[model samples]
Target: MSVTPRTHVRTTALVLPAVLAAALGACSSFDQGTRGIADALTLYRPEVVQGNFVSKEQVAALQPGMTRLQVRDILGTPLVTSVFHQNRWDYIFTMKRQGVEPQRYRLTAYFEGDTLARFDGDDMPSEAEFVQRISRERKVKVPPLQATEDQLAKFPVTPGAEPASSDKGAAPSGAQPALSYPPLEPAR
Candidate 1:
């Protein structure tokens, strides 16, 4: 039997949609695969920093017989506090950044009664050293020192030079004068 022009057109119309649907379904998987590859090849990874950050100076300040409130004041709030363990506080810190090994630190502070008895954890970083480490990694530009003591020393100081007064012909303390202002614009 000879296929008519109408039959050919109907077959093509039905087959075309089926083929397109198959192609579109395949494209979705291909798109997902490409996304996976792109993600794998991505160079920029966001730095993941979490939990309570305790410094060496803060830990050093934590002496025996110190109150829980005092410990919290020095080292900030604890990251982990168990309901079961009423006298224990856990401080955990983790840092994950691109092109750097992940760092994890855990500190456990045990309390006897209401006072902090002792603490055990990895060695902490000093405030200054921690600042330097973070700044160096982020490539932050530090401004140069301006008008240093040596630079200021070059200028001779005038004898009996009174400092400049900020309040020029101002009212005396505890004086409440009359209040006046321009009328407010009417609301639209």
Candidate 2:
């Protein structure tokens, strides 16, 4: 039965290092865990919509001999037009929405002189189809629109107004009598 000071020192030296290493490891692991949590909680990415949108209907309306003014009227201003290629007009549309695949469309118009000679590009979605594609489906829980009798009872009746009637045609109890307003303009 003996305890040496040297042996105590040796034990402490080994155990201290082991404890310190474990504490350091735990702290690093905790740091990593917090990083993972931050990653899981994503930031909001705004939808990016760029360029003029040309719909299938608008494209369908294009004619081989339409004037440049007519083409401009139908499709709005072209997104890309180069001085080098004054006869050509390019329409490009791209949409980036969260939780949905990005959408892109392109349309090119070729003109001979002031008249539109031809037009072509990627098949454009109809307005409805485009709306559907860009829309993100969400399971929104809409609260009930109509209030219950208990909720209605929370509001006090107005002075000089009749209490709410059960009659289907009667106005709500707290409603004030309608007042006539002067015509927006003197009677024509």
Best by TM-score: 1
Candidate 2, residues 2-29, lDDT tens digits: the string is 9899999999999999999999999999
Off by over 4 Å in 2: 1-31, 137-188
TM-scores of the candidates in the order shown? 0.62, 0.56
Prediction-by-prediction clash tally:
0, 0
lDDT to native, each model: 0.85, 0.90
- Which has the greatest lDDT? 2
Error of 2 at 86 (Å): 0.3
Q: Which segments of candidate 1 are over 4 A away from where they belong? A: 1-44, 136-152, 162-188
Candidate 1 lDDT for residue 4? 100
lDDT score of residue 84 within candidate 1: 100
